[model samples]
Structures are given as C-alpha cells and as structure tokens.
Target: MASDQPARRATIHDVAKLAQASTAAVSRVLRDAYGVSDDMAARVKAAMKELDYRPHASARGMRGKTYTIGIVHPDLRNTFFPDIFSAVAEVILPTSRQIMMATSEWTSTEDVFAAMHDRRIEGMIVVAPHISENKLVEAARQAPLVLTHRHSYSTAYDTIVSDDDAGAELVVRHLAELGHKYIVHLGPANGRLATQLSFVTAKRARAYRNAMESLGLGKFAEVAGCPHYTFEDGYRAAHEVLTRSRRPTAIFAGTDNVAFGVIQAAYDLGIELPRQLSLVGYDNTGTGGLGPLSLTSVDQNPHEIGTLAAKMLLSRMDGRESVERASITPQLVVRRTTAEPFE
Candidate 1:
C-alpha cells in the first residue's frame, strides 16, 4: 500500500544543509549580498539547483529588497520593443536584479502599475505610457521610475526618447524628393486630444504636416487616422485612402506593424508598390526587412534607448536625486518599398 502523505517542498534550510553551509551563508548567497565568496556561491547555487529550491518573492520583499525590476509596455506584438528589452537584460545581467515584464494589452496602464507596486518592484521602466503626467509622478513616489518615448518636464523621473520630429521630417522629405506631391500620413487617432499631443504618433503627424508645408506640398498633404496601431487598423485606413479619387502617391505609416497592413491592403487592391504607391514606416523592425516586404522605415535605436533607460533606473535605485533626460537621433533606412511616383 502506498502512503497518502504529501511531499515536503525544498527550502533554504535544505539548501544550506545540502551545501554543508550555515543558513546565514545560504541567505547571503540567495540575496547576492556582499562578502559572499566565489567558491561558496558556486557550492550554494549547485545545492539549490539540485534541491530545486526557489526563493519566495514575498518573503524576500519582507526583508526590504525584491531584487526585481519591472518593465511596462503597451503591446507585446511590436518587435521593436524586444530590442529595448534585450538591451535592458544585457545591462542587468551582471547584477543580482532580474526583470519582470507587464503589458497593457488587456488592462489599463494604471492597473499594470498598481500590480507592479503590489509586487514591490525595486525599479520601473515604462515604455510609451498612456497615463497622465500627474499619475506618473504619483507612481514615481513609490519606486524608482524611468520613462521611454515620452517627453515630460517633470523632475520626478528620467526620460529616454527618440527624436520623433526629426524622424517624421525624414520620411516626409524622402517622399517629397521622390516626386510624390500627394502624400498622406497614417497614424493613431487616440493622440488627437489636446492632452495627448505629446504622444509619439501625434508628434510624428504634426512634424509630417510641418515638413509638407515647408516643401510647398501643404495643399496636397493629408492625414488618415487609425483607431489603433494594429495591422488591421492600417489595412482599413489604407483601403479608405487608396480608394479616394485623389489617391496619395505615397503613404507614411506611424509604425512598421501598420505599414505591414498597408502592404497587404495594397496587394488586395491590385496596386503595385513603388509604382502605384510608395510607403514608409517608422521602427525599422526585422520583419520589415524581409525580402517580400523590404519596407522603408526609420530606426529609433531601441537598443540604445533600452540600455539608457535601464542605467537611469538603476541610478535612481542607487539614490540619484536629480532628474535626467536622454534622446536618440533617428535614421531612415530606405528599402524597396519607396521610389519616385510613376506617371
């Protein structure tokens, strides 16, 4: 007959006993605390691995350090975000800290922040936060905060962003030089509000208009708004604009994901790219560089942005007081998607 008793889970004490070390020594190894020796750390880690022992995050938090950093982003489908995330991981690899990621795809940004707060994350890096500045400032009071893709003058947190204005100008000027007098910009509609004008999409749209005006193409400049940055929104918006009587010879999409939709929509409509329509997208994602797509886009140096954001957050965690801001310049990578308009 088999015994009905439950198996006991491995604990730190088990780890210490297995490693022939005291509980205090095991604790020091787990915390990555100072004064831990190389040989002792190797023995303790091996013992823990053999025992399959995992530290309780809540218990670790009770001791005043979770050794976890939280990263928040709007969408996980965007490939550009992974570049930033990988860079951040590289910077934190040498430290004891680990990263925890949260996405606002199905919940509000506020809810995500609250969840991170509950977990007692040591620091936070919010990418393209949709929340107001006041709310952000309120959250910063609880933990070290760093923001990417947002331009705020608040001294409460550090900011890392790419120059959206310059990037937008680059796309518009490129299309204009390709003999595209009728050019349209497709971007998110959510940023139309007065308060949300600081958003990257809104800034890009404004810069596109300004660049077109400067090039004497103001009369032909148009902006088609997408409800979201998803591929479906891009496809729908493209259909509407491409079907118009005065169809734009060129379209500048707010993101590569959106540009992908435009490509599909143009294909469905029997329109040839670079002949009937020239398209450019922001965020030079890897998928966009595929042979079939070969999309023209602007590179915002997401890796550099992520690296800086992680460093800034770590600095704040280390008790840096003054606010800091860092910006990266954007570069346009022309591919096979764009060319001079065909007569």
Candidate 2:
C-alpha cells in the first residue's frame, strides 16, 4: 500500500530555511552551543519536528558521533513510564542529538529492537525491558545500550535501577507500624522472566513477603498476584484478595496503575480507602499526584533514572565501553490512601 520509491527525508537546511534562521544558528541550537536564545532554540526545534528533519548520522560519523538515539519504554499507557521518557528527553536534548521513542510490552521487545536496527540510532536506552537476559546481551552486542530497571552484573551492558527491595521493605515496615497485621501483596505475574533477578516486581514481592514474616506476622502474609501488569490484572488480583474468606486490612499494590484498579474494585465493593482498606502503590506516577488519587507509593524518582540512563548511553556512545551500573535510592511517600488498620 506504500510507495516503492523512497521519499526524501527532510534535512537540516530545510529546517533552517523554514525557521528563518541562519545555518550557524540552527547548528548552535542543535549542538546546545552557547548563546542561542530560548526563542531561537524553540523555533528551530519546532521547525525541525514539523519537517521530520533528522540530522544524518553518516555526516556526523566523520565527526565521531551520531546525533541520534532510540528509547524504548515499558508500556505506553502506564503513567509512570512517561515520566521516565521525559526525563530521558531532558537529559539528551542539550547534546545536539535526537531521541526516537517506541513502546514494548512485557511480552515482547521486538518493536523496541527494530528501533535499534535503524542506522541513525547509534545508541539505545531501554527502560524496563521485558525481554530475556540472553536477548538483551545480543542486542547490546549490536549497539551501545543502557538498560534501566533491569539489574544484572553482566559486563555486556550498563544498568540503572532503584532499590526496589528496600522500597518494598519500607512499605511492609510502614504497614506493620500501622498495626496492619493482615496485609496483601498484589502484583503482576509476568511469567518466568518476572522471576528473574533482573525484574523489579519480583524483587519487591519477595521483599514484601520477607518483611512481613520477619515481623512475626507470617500468619498474615499473603502474596496474591497475576501474570500481567495491567489495570485488569490489578482489579482481578484485588478482587480475589478482597473476596477471600478473610480480607486483608491493607494492601501493597505493585504499581500506581495497578493501585488504581484496586481502588475502583474496592469502591464497587463499598470499601472506603484507608478506612476499611489501606493501600500502597509503587512508581508514584503522575496520576498518583492528583488530589483524588493521592496514592501512597514508592517513588523510584524515574526522572533521575531516565537522566542517568541517557547519560550512561551517551558515555557508551562516546566509546567508554567497559561496563557501568548505578542504583538510585527509593523513597516512600505516605498519602491519604494508607492508614492504621481499623479495630
């Protein structure tokens, strides 16, 4: 259905011509060279985007750097993911490079890898990739890559992850401090890969159970979860927990999106949050900041994560390719959704 003849990709001159800016002015804006006004930079970027102008990597190759990178995110719908995406954008914007984004499900990373194959994309930033470790290593061999959220000691690629285990412990300890003996851990059952050492949810779930048992509340420790990380999975997992013979007084949902589903299910069951059921979510996403949601969650500080990942990829693209790993600390933000269990 498409034309066989390849269309001409827009060029930097086209952007400069349309923006009414000189070639030097356009170059300075893209390279983040000093002295470009905000207005000038904005105008150049807008014109470039409008014309779909891509600075050819081939031309930059003579200068020993490609002006393009690819970013693959976990999911498009998850509010938490977009924050990370923007963070990556902020970090790369000033470097005179471009970022092309794509979404990949926990089930497949093919769409993401396809972006990597583009000749223009000299480096990749894969956020919370759901593919296997083996596949990741192969991909890294093909291009400079930085994997965020997936943790491993392999020297093949770099990684930046938050302390998810500690984060889960914080939630468990907070619930225990609240006298919530009967607590449930609701999370995605993202198959065997979820059980891998690279997966954050798997780490969090293990930590939650361990923390609860360590507090001598082994009798109340319950891990009810499903295989997918989505709203429907959360609703079903929460519904199962609430419909049990003895419902938990508090719950720790894996992510904020999942917590939203739990909230709706609880509301349908006439359960008031924090009064009848307390909840804590992970990845304090944008939606969680809403007054109505005000979700208590673990803040992974995805901004930091995204920025760090971009920088790491840049380092790799700069040819410093030994291996690097960084961990960002996680913090718990208590909100209106969590409270002391009722009598």
Candidate 3:
C-alpha cells in the first residue's frame, strides 16, 4: 500500500546536520555572511546539493536580508549602460548576492522603486534617475543606495560620475584644433537649464559653450536641441542643422547613440563625413569603434564606474554610513570621423 503524504522538503537544519555544522553556520552560509571560510562554504554547499535545499526568499526577507541588489535605470536600449551592468555583475559574482534589474521603460521610476522595495532589495544602484532629490533621499533612507551619472549632492547616498566638464572641453578643443571654426552641439533639449540643474547634459552643453568662447569661436557656436538621447532625436536635430544655410563644419553629439543617428542622417543627405563635416560624440561605446563608423568619442571608463558603484553599495550594505562621491576622468579617442573642414 502506498502512503498519501507529500514528500518532505529539506530545511537548513537538515543541511547543517548533513554537513556536520551548526544551524548558525548554515544560516551564515546561506546569507553569505561575513567571515565565512571557504572550506565551510564548500562543505555547506555540498550538503545543500546532496539534499537539494533551497532557501525561501520570503523567509529570508522576514529576517531583514534578501541577499539581492536592485539596479534601476531609465532605458536598457542604451549600449553604454550594458558596460556598467557587466562590470557590476563581475564584481558581485563571487558573492552569494544576486542582481535584480528594473527599467523605467514600461513603468514609472516610482513604481520600479516601490517594486524593488517590496522585494526587500538589500542594496540599490540607480543610474541617471529622473526623480526629484527629495524622493531620491527618501529612497536612500529605505535601503543602501548608490547613484551613477547624477551630480546632485546627497549625504544619504553615494555617487559615481564622470567629469562631464572635462569631457565637453576635450570634444570642443579637439574640434577647434582641427581648424573647425563653425561647430554645432547636439544635446538633450533640457541642456539649456544647466545653470539651474546639475544634469549631465546641461553640464556638457555649458562646458561646450565655455570652451568655444575661450577659443574665440563663440559667435559661431550653436546648440541644436534633441528631444531625447535616442537616435531619432539625433537624426532630427542633425537633419535640421545640416539643411541650414550656414551649416556647421562639425557636430558634437551628446552621446554615441545620438552620434550614430547623425552618421545616418549625413549618409542620407549626401554629406561626406570628415571631408564635408566632422563629428564627435560622448560615451565611447563598443559600437562606436566599428571599422566603418569609427566615431570619435570620450571614454568615461564606464566599467570602472560600475565597479566603483558596486563596491560602494556593498560598503553601504555592510554599515558604512559616510557618503562617497567618486568622479572618473574622461579621455578623448580621436577617430576617422573628425578632420579639418574641406575648402
């Protein structure tokens, strides 16, 4: 006769017993708690494998640690973001903590933050958040928070950013040195508000103007506003400027993605790159290095930024209270797209 009872599920106690370790040790192993030895971890993992043990996430959350880190970003379509994500993943690989990503593509940033909170994420890394400073500070109070690409000052959270001013200066000076007097900047629409806000786009735009003025080309300096950082906005802005009676000899795109659009627009308009018009973009994304594209860009060291953000988040999670602000220097990579304007 067969019994009607369901099979028993393995518990932490079972794992501890099988591994000849205490329940506390098993718990620490499960949490990836500090001071855990490799030998102990190996024994516990072996026991867990043999018993097919799986820890309940909800139960772990009840104890105040979910062993999960949340990453909140505006869009996943941006290639530069993936570099940061990969670097973060590599840093967190040796730990038991896992990553949970949430994008503001379909939902609001508030909703995404709420969902991450509901899941009890131990730490959070917010990339270029569009939320207000007050809301961001409030979220930081709820969990360990690290911000990337945002320059707002906050004592409650850590920040990792690139030197946007230096990056913009590099692009402007590079173009100016190439004997291009008429230079146009294509940046986010809100860049005009740089005087009021610390937004990255605004900073870059302001820096570009300052550089152009210092180089005695302020009269010819122009900025064409893009609705967003997408390729469509870039294309639209480029097309508008390119068709003008007094066209710029060079275009400084705010981002690599936008630069790609500028390239396509140039192709459609029969403007020969480097020969007729020069171009420079920010964010040295991998695709910009293609043999045909050969986009000149500013390298913000996104991988290093990502690594720093992860480490800071972990430090905050481990009870570090002091806020950290890390800024990475940008480098200009000159490619084939930029040259002296043809006579």
Candidate 4:
C-alpha cells in the first residue's frame, strides 16, 4: 500500500510544520521553558510522538552542550605524546565525543583553555603540563580533569603515570645484569648548580643515582646535565661524556628524545653502539620500534597510559567524585642498542 507520509523519517522541522508551531516554540516545549502555553506544548508533544521524533540532548540545553573533550600537551611534536593522543582518540570515538587538542605552548594555551571553559567540554586530559598541581586542581573544580605525567596527587582530579623512579631502576638493573658498571645517567643538569624543572625527569635521575649507589658503583655514578630535553643538549652532553679519557660503558638516557641526540653524537664521534658504547632510552615511543632504531628502552606503553587517562576522565565525567590514581609498572624493551661490555 502506498503511504501518504514522506519516505524519510520525520525531523524537528517536520514536527514544527505539522504542528503549525514555530521552531522556537518547539524548542521551548522540549526544554520545558516557562512561557510555552498548554496548547503549544500538547501540539509539539503529539506531533513528536506521531512522527516518533526523538530530541537530542546535545541540541537543547540552558547553556547548550558541545559534547567535546579538550586535550592539552606541552609539545605536540614530541614522538611519545602522539602515541598517547592516538590511543585517546580511539577510546573517544565510540562515545560520539569530539576530541580537541591544545598545545600549552604560546598563545594556544589561552585558546585551548578558553575552549575548555567556554566550549562546554565535559572533561579534559592534560599531559606534562607546566602549571603547578594546585593550579590544576583549581581548574578541575570547574570541570572533570585527568592528568598524565604531572605528579598530581589531588583528590580533586584523576592521575595516571608510569612509575618513573621504578622505570629508572629497571634500566639500571638491566645495565647491571649486562655486566656494565660504568653507567652514566644523562638527563637534566647535575650538581648543586644543576636545575631540573620537571619532576618526572628529576625522579628518574634520582632513581638512577640511587640505583647506581645501591649497586656498589656510587663512586662511578655520574649525572650529566643536558640543560633541557632537546636533542642538541643531549648531543652536547653525550659528546662531553663519550669524548672523555674514561668513557662510560653504558648510558641511561632520561628519555628517548635525549637518546636520539646521544645516538647522533655517538655516530659523529665514530663510536659503535653496543660495541663501544651500550645505550638505552626511556619511553618506548612508537618511533623507537621501527627496526632501524629498535631502541632498547623502558616501555611506558603510551597507548596504555592514554587509555587509562581517557577511561578515568570519562568515568569522572559520569559523576564519580572520588579521586582515582593509577600507576603502570614499566617494562624493559631489550633491543639492538644494548649488549654486554667486552672485556
């Protein structure tokens, strides 16, 4: 039998047309607005039911909802962070949520937070933010927040991290097992004059020093300051360390980026990796696995880190108020870059 109704399903506009009411009136009825009259409300409801029309919660709110989540990271170009971002995106997709990224660098900080505050985002994920934990906690009062790599212990927000100290110990133990005692930990600058601004790196360096001393190699424990996480700083530090009269048998780089710089310096100095110099990096970022580099490193499994952060954020958004803190124990990925020291 031929039907009189249109082939396509009814829409809000169709309901408005059939009920002889303005779209605003229909909107008012849907929102239970004060001014909508009895006749108008009844007409809108009848039309909606006749057409089996459903209202989307996102479409109508006192302030309106955007159904968006904001993600803020310090450096968008860093290889390690992107893997986390990819994992977060995959988790968000099934929920019909849109993911917006913010770089805490430059003017983007203002733009990103403005979106978080003004764009009506239900929640946010921040990685290695430069801001203090208290400031972050203050911000969390306004919205649900999940922080990664920021040393957050606030009961007001969620935090997830790969245990940096333990990860460092794993590296030191691995090197020790491989018969390397002359291990030099290359990271932030060393000594009373040394300064390391990020707690994550500072913790790793401390663990490295502690591990070395505990291994009865305290006299040989050396910390080379790279000034920063930048590759050039790493290269310069490595150059200084490797070009010495007594070079380290192994190097535990603070992070993979630093390791990349160290690797370059090794090549420039005509040193063979795992032959003349055994080296390892932290943060088994995706790029480190691509065969040519196949870096022996500590695996935080950024994908897992991101997934945990996302789950916590979503759960927090669902009105669970208790603070959730999670730590993923790290693993050592043995690759081409490490080997036993030749006698």
Candidate 5:
C-alpha cells in the first residue's frame, strides 16, 4: 500500500534490470523497433514506466533521425532577423521538432555548416547566406533545406523571399508622389551582385534604377556607393549625395539602419528633414515611427516572412516536396519623412 519512491536517475541498464530483460530488449522496446514480442515489449514498457527511463539522445541519434532543424543567419544584432526568428518559434511551438541555430558573421560558410553537421541536424534554414549556389546545393545533400531572404541557383532547396524588386518600385513611386524629381538611392556594393547568395542586395538596387527610369527621372537617379549597411556607411554616402552641386531633392535608403545614419548626417550638416530633403527607407524598423525621425519606409513584415519560411521548411521536412517556395508580399508604410519638394 506504500507509494514507491521515484527511481533516481533512470538508465537503460536499470530499466533492463527491472524488466528482467537484456539491454537490447529495453532499447528495442524504447524505440518501438521491429522483432520484439508483445510480452517482451510490455515488460520493458512497464519497467520504463516504473523507472521513468528516457533514452539518451546520442543513442537515439545513432539509429536514423533526430527530428532537429538548423538555422544559420548572417547577423543576430539586427532586429529584422530576431523578429523573423520569433515568428518562426511561434510556428514551431506546436510541433515535436527542435531548432538549432548558428551565425555566419560574414566569415567561413564551412565553419557554420560544420557546426550544424556536428549536431546531426536533419534539415536547415539559411538566411542571407554568403555561400555559393553550387555549395548550397552540396550542403543540401546533407539535409532538407529552406532559404530565407536568399535564393539558391541550384533549384534543389526550397526558398522564400520578400519581393525586393516590388518593394523598390513602391519606394520610387512614393518619392514621385511626394513631388521629388531628384532622388538618390544609397545602395549596397557591387560584391552583393557577384555573390551567389540568393538574397542579393543588387536586386533591390536594380529595382531602384528601374523605378527611376519608369518615372522618367533616370538622369537624376544615381546610386551612392556603400559597402555595407552600417551607420557610418550611410552617413558618408548621404553626405556625398547631399553636398553635390546638384544635390538630390530626396534620398532613399536600402535599410532602416542606413536611413538612421543618413538622418544623423543631415542633422550634422544642419539640413532640415522633409522640408529640405524628403528621406525614405526600407525595412520599417522601430525608429521609423520615432517622434524625432518619423521616417517613411516599406514594412517588409519580418515576422510574416519568418513564419512563411518556417512553414515552408516544415512542409519540406514533413515530405511535402511540391511546396518549394513561398512569396510574401510587402507593403509601403507611409509616414512623415516624405513630402513635396521645398521651394
């Protein structure tokens, strides 16, 4: 009638000993593998129930699958990816799957891939990767793969991308609507175009150029050179663009962070925002809504993007091969940073 104390630190051997069976029999029962008789399995199950024994993960990994997914991102400090990750976690909450993560830091892709391999992840989601198309295809051979904000030229793995081109067009149209004829687009460096990564920054640059041409301001549209999306990069680019003899009446930035830098540069040079220069940015980060900045920008909806990418990855992992890519439409979030050109 007395309650039995919980077995301390349950192990496979302890379960086998309690069940009066071999270690192999206990493992077979735990895994529900073939060849174990009903009575034998029942005995082992009863022992495990009594002992509260759980199989070691390393041991479980040996058989075949672990139901784990890996995610590699280029930067974690940025709010965009963190928002996306939160969305992904929401989607994954109901599933038995687990996620492992790594950051690339614009360094060796091999190191990140190796880290994932060491964990024996069954699938992967790589965001804005720096690896080559051929290398991505090769990497996919190790696991089912999903790409976010990047594309694979191999057509082997599933990809989900925000419509950067469409987003760029929308930005240009917004500037035109604000009655600004002279606009400059501070763009990512040429290396972005040459890289084999699916999330090519040049795609947005091209969109910026096309939008200007379509609006009949091609002659006035110039792309300022920025090697990276940092505050200093934006500040320098904005300074050069603003100081020109024929200064741009308006400026569009590729990212919110870059726009912040541009705004700072404008203040440093004693230029009034929107009154002297209509500034717009992409990514729609929190700063866009600040009382001081009020930056008009495009909302890429990183949460929705991350959710779609996670769903795409899960579908592929669950054996749904046909759903290779998911495209989420973007919207322009208009705010105070844009206005009619000053006299």
Candidate 6:
C-alpha cells in the first residue's frame, strides 16, 4: 500500500528550504550538533514532519551518515536495558547519531552477527554472554564494536564492565553485617557463556568465598540454585532455600528482577523479609526502590554503563584506539530488605 516512486526521501536542503534556513543549519538541527537555536531546531523538525521526510538510508550509506548505532542487549523482556538504552540515546543526541538495538537473550552470536550484518549497521555495541574471543574479533572485523558487561578478550574492540567481584563481596559483607551466619548465593545458570568467565560468575563465586572466609563463616557459604536471570528463576530458587533444614539467614541474587521474584516467593510462603530471613540483590534496577520491595542491592548503574559503552564505541569508530577497556565499580544500595538476624 506504499508508493515505489523512489519513496521521495527528503534531503537536508528540503528541510532547510521549508524552514527558510541554510542547509548547514538544517544539518545542525538534525545532528543536534553545536550552535543550533531552539527555534531553528523546532522549525526543522516541523518541516521534516510536514514533508514526511525520512532521511534516506542509501544516501546515508553514501556519506557514512547512517547516523545509527546498534546495541546488542541480553533481552528486552527485562526492564533493565530500556532505562539504560534511553540514557545512551540521550547521551548520543549531542553526537547526532540514533540508537538501534538487538538482543541475544543468551542466543547464538552467529544469529546476532547475521542480523546486524543484514541490517548494515554502521557500528555495534554487543552485550552478550561469554562469547568466544575469535567470534568477537570476527564481529569487530565487520564493524566498529564495543562490549558491555563483558571484558575484552581480544584487541579488536573496547569493553565496558562493572566491578562484579566487588559487587559479590558487597552482598556477602552486607549479610555478614546483619549477623547472618548462613548465606546462599543465587547466581546465573551454568549454560550461558558469562557463567564460564574467569571474572564474572566465577569471580563472584570466588569473591563470596573470600568474603565468607574473612568473616570466619566460610562453612555457611553455600552456592545454591543456578537461575536463568529471571524473576521466575529467582522464585523457584527461593522455594529451594525455604525448604532447606538449615536455611540461609539471607539470600543474595545476582540481579534485581531475580530478587523481586524471591521476595514474592517469600511473601507467598508467609516468610517475613528481613525478619525470618534477609534478602539482597544486585543491579539496582529501579524495582529495588519500590515501597513494597525496597530490596537492598548493588548499583551496577546500567545507564552509566550504556552511556560509557556508546562513547567507547564512537571513539573506536573515530580511530582513537585499537583496543580499550573501562571498568565501573558497583555500589551497595541499602534498603529495607536487609536487617539484623533475628533471635
């Protein structure tokens, strides 16, 4: 039901002419670059809307003005990335580029690459499970690349990651501070590539052990269920914890959604949070601050993570460096979910 008359893709001159301005000014409005007045920008946008002027994809390819960046997330079903993605877009506004997204959902990287390649994205930001070093290098060979939540395995791209080891330690230390004698860690399921990392799930496990030993409560440190980063996974794990004879006094989930589900499970069992048992989770994904949940968690700052990753990718595309890496420290956010161990 659409016209095939070349689709009449609007050009910068069209918008400029309609707005009674120069093409450079219109370009500035489109790029959100330096020195465009608010009135000018509004007029340009209005003209663009009136003309139904979509920037031509092929023309953009000609000028390398695709003005688009692809972000590969874990899954959109989880609310985590929406917030982060919005933040990244906000930061990119000044740079005049738009954001696009893809998700692996723990799916195959080959599938991710095929989709990205077919789309002809100018550059990409991949946040995948533990991917092979060679596979990531190959993907970078195709386009400019930046990785989120994973470390750089090769010099082909940049990496933006959080201090997950310290994050794990924070959870255990919080439980120790609350006088918890026994603590159980609910981590990612073993199937994903992330779980196989020397520095991710493995690092968290090691950090938990170190923290427990430091508190002289190593015997109480137990690795419980491996949930697949979901509320339902957390819910099921909570049931297992509740059934334990010497149940952990506190539970630490690797992510916030998982913690939310654990809280729900505890409520259903008539267990009092922070009373009969304390709860803690990672990734302060807004949900932790809800009045009912108020989950104590580690702030992985996903928005900051996204913003930083985009900057890294852009820098690489600009030929700033061959390989660069950055790390963010995760902070503990204390709320109502954790309390002193009850007698």
Candidate models: Cα lDDT each: 0.89, 0.84, 0.90, 0.82, 0.80, 0.78
Give lDDT for model 4. 0.82
Q: lDDT for model 2, on a 0 to 1 scale? A: 0.84
Poorest lDDT segment (10 consecutive residues) of candidate 3: 189-198
Estimate the overall C-alpha local distance difference test score of candidate 6.
0.78
Q: Candidate 5: minimum summed lDDT over ten consecutive residues — where?
A: 191-200
Which residues of candidate 6, in runs, are more than 4 Å off? 1-11, 22-52, 188-195
Rank by lDDT (best first): 3, 1, 2, 4, 5, 6
lDDT of 3 at 339: 96
Candidate 2, run of 10 with poorest lDDT: 188-197
Using TM-score as the measure, name the better of candidate 1 and candidate 3.
3
Tell me the spans in candidate 4 whose CA falls farther than 4 Å from its real position: 1-63, 107-115, 190-198
Residue pairs with backbone overlap in model 1: none
Tens-digit lDDT string for candidate 3 (111-201)? 8999999888988999987788888998999999999997887899999999999999999999999999999999865533444346787
| Model 5 C-alpha lDDT per residue in residues 264-319, reported as the tens digit of each score | 98998888988999888888887677877888888888888878878877767667
- Backbone clashes in each candidate structure, one number apiece? 0, 2, 0, 1, 2, 2
The model with the greatest lDDT is: 3
**Local accuracy of candidate 1 as per-residue lDDT tens digits, 1-343:** 8889987789989999999999999988876778999999989989988988878878888889998999999998988899999999998754657789999888999999999999889989999888888899998999989999876657888988899899999999999898899998888654343126668877888888899999999998777877567899899999999998879999999899999999999999999998899999999999998998999999999889989999999889989999999889999999999999989
Q: What C-alpha lDDT, on a 0 to 100 scale, does residue 249 get in candidate 4?
A: 89
- Is candidate 2 or 6 superior in TM-score? 6
Evaluated at residue 210, the lDDT of candidate 3 is 92
Q: Which stretches of candidate 5 lie over 4 Å from their true place?
A: 1-56, 151-153, 192-198
Q: Clashes in model 6: which pairs?
A: 130-193, 130-194
Q: What local lDDT does model 4 show for residue 115?
A: 65
Q: If both were scored by TM-score, which would come out higher, candidate 1 or candidate 4?
A: 1
Error of 6 at 177 (Å): 1.3
